[model samples]
Target chain A: MQRLLYSLSGASGQHYSPHVWKIMMSLKHKGLDFELKPVSFGDISKIEDGSFTSVPVLNDQGTLLGDSFEIAEYLEETYQDAPSLFDGPGGLQLSHFVESYCKTVLHPTLAVIAVMDMYNIMSDADRAYFRPAREKRFGKSLEDVYAGRDAELSTLPEKLNPVRDLLTNQDWFGGEKAMHADYVLFGTLQWCKVCCPDPILAPSDPVNLWFERMLDLHDYMGRKAVSEAVAA
Target chain B: MQRLLYSLSGASGQHYSPHVWKIMMSLKHKGLDFELKPVSFGDISKIEDGSFTSVPVLNDQGTLLGDSFEIAEYLEETYQDAPSLFDGPGGLQLSHFVESYCKTVLHPTLAVIAVMDMYNIMSDADRAYFRPAREKRFGKSLEDVYAGRDAELSTLPEKLNPVRDLLTNQDWFGGEKAMHADYVLFGTLQWCKVCCPDPILAPSDPVNLWFERMLDLHDYMGRKAVSEAVAA
Candidate 1:
């Protein structure tokens, strides 16, 4: 039996990784045996520097696995008894939508807007310094950060409808059982929730309802290796 | 005999994705049959709002796959006869590095900085006004981007030294023989070359040499994909 370690970090509100939470639930739900360790963000001093290794890393014995997508894919596939992230055509299709949501929709629009300085967390001096400085570079204003997001939200219906349709058609995004698509959506939506105000993009009641059901499994995480505090 | 359809954007210089290139090469090296299609960047709008879905997406019949990481991982497992990206422990280690390189080093540093304006062919205003504007957001001026990157470049030896040191121990990044690690490095570094003038953090002669070797792999990219028209 390979002992697994999940290294992750979330402190204050700076951490936007819902991946840790989802994985915790998945592993527990599957009853897969593994260790979990929450790593602090930016502990490069712990890095070998030769490997330039960073965390949200998974270590099995000495071998390392990281990258949320890769990690999720590997875990689901390697564990025969576990739920899968990608099952068939519908699963594959929803994955395409979620990928865009993370990078195109979430990273730029949500992540840029909801940082500490971007919010009221930072002191005025700090805001004037790093916030204004980075803002000019990405080519937007403090206002423009969320300005056209309303417009961008309008476009999600066509892009996300496929997945939205999946919600009602199947118990999960993959159209059979809840699998990796649920986790990916859960993670991205979590990140979006932290980084940007929830956009009333589409009538996402089913998506919201699915989240309520997901919590039933989160208790399974408490019975697993990553039961520390949970993402509050 | 699953017919893999690879749709690539017509342009080559900046939008070049190393992940796509890696999968393409893996399929070729294995003599696995796949159909190659050159997709225009955004000439025809996709069902999704994103252009990436319109680019280098793979279809097994009508089944869709998106995102370089996902697509490459999909290909790696779906076709066992195709060159494997993840073989075992050592291969997984390299895959993590490739994933990290994409997120930590490549996306924020290289893609955001060098390839920003290249994403959309610059109008005069984009060239003059937006070019410099985007560069500064990286917390470095163009000159600073160069200088700041030297520190990051030195770190690569650490992240990669495990493999480079392995060359003395065995063959490619994975060890005994060339595995997906070689292709991952190739794709990422190729993305660096096309997107950024600098390779391996600076004018790296070693990287240049390796690049030449990778290009020689006949099916590395369909020769016609990067013809005079797309090469522009």
Candidate 2:
């Protein structure tokens, strides 16, 4: 059986979609061998039967799955013999909490901070689709939104205090080992690292330290990702 | 062996301390029989030895434990045969994240919103102690801090988006059942309900729905708490 993960990619092969990275780490966590098929944002909907609307549409030997959380659940339930993605009880709830934190708290902040940088790195077709879509969502031009980038970036660390505080007492968000919760956060942080040159987290910050450890996970899967700097 | 939980109470027996409520729900979750001993703010230090300076100092058999997190760990370890508090693997880390969320995000906002109400409900001695201590911490008079109550209250529901989003898909933060994470948040919401007449969460919000379920937990332990309106 062949496994394939369709991921959102940049012009220079940068995998910057946080949702895609989550599945990437999750597949590796379950010890599944898979191929990464990169798709531009404009091409995401055409990945399979044109029914899908996003990246991270996983095809597990013809069994198609969409949505990162749903795919994770599928992986956990199907590959029960492998290491668990949720680890124990409350894992699903905790993972969802982390996801919400990223979606509500962190993503908005990052979108403002990385708007221009993200646009510059995207394929022309994706850039054409991205600007008008995001501008409509923000009710402003991309340039206007990116104008407040520094102020928006300043709030990122404080927003991450809960994660930092959790790390202060435990090695991983999954308690002793990295689980879906850790991957959820790691994917978000990795998105920022890949798209933007400015460090979202300070070097001395505990979150950065955890990110370093996360980068070293699954045979340095994250470390091997092509960042904007490396791509440049 | 006798079990007792020392909780901070107001002049009219209003048990409003969030930390104390966490242990209360936790004890009930573990099905442990215990007494809730109410203490004024000034009476905390003398609860056991003069070394302790907080509520939620749990006396299990002869061993005393301070700090709600520590007491939870102790409970999970001591009552290994009972219903677990930290349900599965990442329970500890997730519980801590919930605690940090309440402490960092919710508590400051609540402190500002409930400053006057909390002060008014306290005993004379506690009022005197709390006013000066909290004022000094905020670098302003309690009255001045309370002036910003409306603004502080407005920011609370937004801060709770992560929790609200989590509750959108799951019945409890502890997944299928209420665990330490659910208790952690329940304690914070219960503190607001006990300390003020104002509703922190809108009655129709999903979070409020979850809070209702939480109140119904442990044989109506939370529902039985004396709220400010009831006390009045």
Candidate 3:
């Protein structure tokens, strides 16, 4: 069966959507060969017969799947004999906890820190749609919303204290192996890495070290991905 | 073989130490029969031997274990035939993540919100030790530390947003069944319930609902425990 993953991309072909990256890593972990189809914001709704409105809409043997978590669940159940994304019973809940942590704690912080950098890297059409939507959400212009970027960026390390402490004791969030939980966090960090030049984690920090190790996984797929910030 | 768990308690015999509660819940989950020995802050160092200086020193068949996480590991490994505290592979890491969350996020916030209540509930000896130690940690008097508690308490719901979101779709942090991850968070909330008059969670919140369900677990052990704040 042919598997194709539709991922959100930048003008320079940088795959930066955290949700899309999550499914990419999950598919790789399950040893599934998949092709990536880059999509712009304007192209999302038109994919898979206008049924979906998001990046990471996976087409597996002509069956369309949306939402990273739902796609992960589908992959886990369908490819049951393949290496498990969730190591065991409690893993599904923990992976969801990691997802929530990324959404509630990390995403907003990253959005503020990388607002201008993200704008600089997007296609003109995406930029047109991004500004008004984000301004409406923040109730402020992009420039005004990102004015407190330094203070927001300083809070990132403190917010990541739990993850740092976890990495201090274990090699991965999934204990010995990197599972969906690890990928969930990796995707968030990867989003920042792909779009922003300022480093989210220090080189000496355990989380940064873990990120480097994660980049080496699956034949250095993350390391080889184009960083729009670096490219520009 | 007899099993004994030394737990930190207040003057009115409320088991309020979050660390101790974690072991209590773990022991129950593993189906191990144990006795709870209530101790004050001053009594911690003198529990099993002078080697340890903390509560939750588990004495099992002559083997002494300190640290809640270590005690849990010992229980899980030693009682391999019994039920597991960590349901599977990733569970250990996720359980640790929950522990780190309680330590980094919840503990400090709870300490400030319940400072006065905790001080009031402590034994005279523990009060002398707790006040100076805590005051030094905050670099202020207990009164000053607690003065900003209303603001600090307000941030707790936001801090607990991840857990609340996790519980929205699952019954527990441990997925279908309550495991160590559930116990890890339960211990933190249980500490506040035991020591403070003000409820940390609103009655209608998912976290509050989950707490009520947690209290009913292990044959109502948490619900049956005395609340020092309520007693006074």
Candidate 4:
């Protein structure tokens, strides 16, 4: 009857999958105790009878669930007494828009910006699987993608224009407090922070300041991660 | 004690300001009665003792307010018994993100796409005021800006990637029904519809379908507006 989260781990057991971090923060937000079972990219298929293809697959007691948003909803529904991940259905619905923003606006530049670091931190087997998979996805070799990293990095601030504009008036995406929307964005940025040696956001930028506050949330849950930002 | 919304009017008495449309939808959403006072770009300064410089200035029985979001908040607070614009604070807060998305992602492309049509639809006084003002903002003559419009139009579907992704799962941004977030996006597209002969979204696109539904909302309030889309 143990709650277990199957997370994609890198070299030295670093958990850096943005989607996995989303569930990681959600679990902690719900005040739920769980075991982190680290699986490499090659090892992903070996978990749970090879039923799930991705990481952040949560095995809650006997039930198994994948997909971060679905897991967030499941957690909210199951752990009714816990701090609500979404304050209400309104927050819950709009949280999807936040997800959409991250995917459409942030993902392309970040994937390019962090791909090299992400590859460098992976175990040999994971690296073997990751490189070809990602190259095929981008239709370019990993090195070619990494060559454009500086150009991609230059666009990061403009990609984050919406978030920077939002932060000027509110402290969090959740209005007064950090909610699922905040975590969705945090996980996106945290992925880059954990992998890339160069910081994605400028220190003085309001979005970065909000990320600093997010890192301090839940007893510095994000800060505790093995990030290149921390190493630098 | 009539509620009057001062809006920017076009050549044929058309209210085409996106910000003004936001207030228009919001007023109807709250089931409140308000008169639409048409003011051209030149007439904006004459409204409310020349205090505000924007359209969508609401004189709620003599309590003057500018800014669409602030006006929405005021309406939500004053007419508590009416249907909620935001279901709660969560929606209210996330609605800002929608506004930011519309501003950052949609506005740039749309302003360029509709510049010529907008110019054509304006009265002589408005055209006189609008041309130099918009040229100053864009740093190009109206003809030069319009020359690159098709290029701007080409980027629109990609710009709307987030909205298209959101529409796949939910019928409205508000989940079950239309909310302020929907109105925010609706106002953006509705502005283009009222001016531009070239429809921005593809006819079969899911985003366009949702907009069709938005037009049918509140007893066809949006469709009742004078639009090039309807004219075409």
Candidate 5:
């Protein structure tokens, strides 16, 4: 019986999905070992009887899980003796607020900022499926979406102000230790780190510094991940 | 030991300061009874020898405290057996993230949206001080600052998406019960509820519903407050 994680991979095999990176770091945080199987855009629906539509689908020795938040909860409940991801109920619920921040504030901005770069790094089959879908969703051509990204890019720091403000007084989102809240935000930034050619944050920014520290966590799993931008 | 909370009040003696409201709710949440003392803008500098510059100053029998977060930590540490504001360190730290959200996203937008309303509710003396100070800060006259508020008002909903998204699945920021994070946001929205003439949230919005629940907490403390908007 083996644990397996189906992840979204870039053309060059960089595990680039933000949601997948969340569970990837969370699994490592819980001291769980799993084989990472890369899946392309077109391959997601075919992962398990066409039931799942996203990556970070965990096959934990026959128990299949889909959403990243659900997978995090499963890992926490299943590995009770391991280091707790959420310290208690307060941490657990507030972690959702962090997730909300990532979704509403970070994801949408990063999506526009890195759309073309994200498209450029996708497999041909993935690109074929991605372009029309995203173009329709964004209501613009991929190139057109990429054109106004400088304006979008300029807004990233302001979009990240909350995290920057939090980091001004604390080393991590989880206070003295890193927790799921930290991972939720790290996952968002990690997406841009792996995809965007233009730098998303300043080197001296507190959030950027926190990201640097996050990359070194879990024995450098994030640092060692097959980053497409790094490979370039 | 007498516990006294110096709160900022409007002309009609409404406790309108967002930071003060946080401590007000947190005090009640911990079941610690304190006398509420109203302070005008001019009186803040004269409070306890002019050292402290803000309201929500907690004078717990001569152990005067300033800063809402500091006061919260003091309560959490001083009263270990009471119902915890933060369930643990994780919750404590994440509450700061909530604070950051209130400061960057909610406060700025609400400040613009309710600038004139806030001025109108203040005493004539406060209006004089507030007008020049705000004009200097905004680089515009009070009327002009408020003239452009409709555009600012339109941005509030999207700005509040993070909180709205969080409340969809959970009863409160603390999951089963309210915590400091809930108070943190409650204080923010309650500021608008007391001062803003136009409704800041839709009647059916999840955030508005959560706020309604919040007002009813602590035996209708929020509902019982001398609301200037209610008086108007």
Candidate 6:
């Protein structure tokens, strides 16, 4: 029997990145036999110090794999018989674009949003809890970051103009097909909306419709409809 | 006839980011019937603010393949018998580590070296010519950067520790065969040596030996012998 396991966050499952939940929920809906193991990116001093002996690794019959992109690749390769999110060179191209969008553009933008959202939603005591972890990673004062929020937020709209342009009247970034890239982008966007609800992306674009459609995917709403409803 | 076009800048070539060249040389050696065309990364305006249309796209039979890793993957998939630097899952793992090292550590390190080599090696007027682009890409403040060079340099040791620990005094980064990862890392190392000679890595430990073996490779040395004889 084929099995899969994901390292997830236990305490901050409230602030869990949508990408993680997407993978977990996808497997669950498939009714596949799998296990979920919580892995902490929040305070991964062990990873930082190079004791990455066990972390977010996907195991295929006990063979461990690392790197989210690599794990995705391995899953695709190993489960060749499984329902595919990839189509061909075209699909690969689309997936590659989504990865780039997430890695280079959206991910960083979402990170900035995370800081803003934490401050906005969290209590003084609650903010204190997250601030230290963030400080370790960014080495910046949250007050200063918060002070410059409008300026930081302003630049994103222009940065997002290109993404918005791509989304203009399109059902998905990868065109008509709901490929892996769409799901990947959706995961990041979902996170961004929670972590940084910018009105710029809220206006009518075909992408918003696509976002709504993904919520209707099997187990997607079941797993997190309550959470997403709150965030939305 | 199958064709591929590489977008390039003759001067940005000086940064000697070997990931660009490794792909170039790989294609050159792969003996695939193809053509190379140079394009600009700065010409995002031409792309009209689209998604992830970054450097080094391979145009094969009118299909656009961007992202060097994906390009390599596409070629490997499309051409079964092309001379492959990567072979299997271990090959994938090694290539990933090399990519991670390059982006996270080596390329940034080498960029510093490239500037210095250009500074030390370039004539006063030639320095004037290349300064703006370097300044634009890296930053205008060389003295500030050079001040923290030792600190930044320390990260290289820490970063390479994984490869070093896993290698355990081996012939290659991925066991016996010189795989894609070795080539990728070697390309960066080679670029750094040419662009900036460093005591840390120049007369260093495993780096020195690894350098020798990489240069000893027929394809690698062939390029070296050409570059050495040519006046850059």
Worst 10 residues of 2 chain A by lDDT: A223-232
Model 4 misplaced stretches (Cα beyond 4 Å): A227-232, B227-232
Best by lDDT: 5
Candidate 3's C-alpha lDDT?
0.86
Instruction: Mark the regions of model 3 whose C-alpha exceeds 4 Å error after superposition.
Output: A227-229, B227-229
* Deviation in Å, model 3, residue A77 alpha carbon: 2.8
Any residue pairs clashing in model 5, and if so which?
A: none
Write one digit per residue (lDDT tens) for candidate 6, span B1-232.
4576554334433424365555664565455655655444454224322444555656677777666667667766677686555654334322443465466545676566455654655445446655676667766666555666777677666545444544444566545555555666766665655555554563556666676777767556524643652355
| Displacement of the residue A63 alpha carbon in candidate 2, Å | 2.3
CA lDDT scores, all candidates in order: 0.50, 0.86, 0.86, 0.88, 0.89, 0.54
Clashing pairs in 3: none
Worst 10 residues of 2 chain B by lDDT: B223-232
- Candidate 2 lDDT at B57 equals 91
Candidate 5 lDDT tens digits, B1-232: 7999998878878778999999999999999899988888899988875788888899998898999999999999999999999998888989999999899888888888878988988999899889999999999998998998999989989999998898998979999899999999999988877887677899999999999999899999987773534774
- Return the TM-score for each candidate structure: 0.40, 0.95, 0.94, 0.94, 0.95, 0.44
lDDT ranking of the models: 5, 4, 3, 2, 6, 1
Question: In candidate 1, what are the lDDT values of residues B107-178, reduced to their tens digit?
Answer: 554544445424443334334654576566665555556555656556554433323333343334433445
Model 3, A147-187: lDDT tens digits are: 98998989999999889888888898878889898899999
lDDT of 5 by residue, A1-232 (tens): 8999999988888778999999999999999999999999878888865799898899998999999999999999999999989887778889999999899888888999889988888889999999999999999899999999999989988988899889999998888989999999998888878887667889999999999999999988888873434774
lDDT (10s digit) by residue, model 4, range A103-192? 988998899998999998888998889988999999999999999999988988987888988989899988888888899999999898
True contacts kept of each: 0.00, 0.68, 0.65, 0.62, 0.74, 0.00
Runs of candidate 5 with Cα error greater than 4 angstroms are A48-50, A226-229, B226-229
**Candidate 1: Cα lDDT at B196:** 45
**How much lDDT does candidate 1 score?**
0.50
Each candidate: RMSD: 14.0, 1.9, 2.0, 2.2, 1.9, 10.5
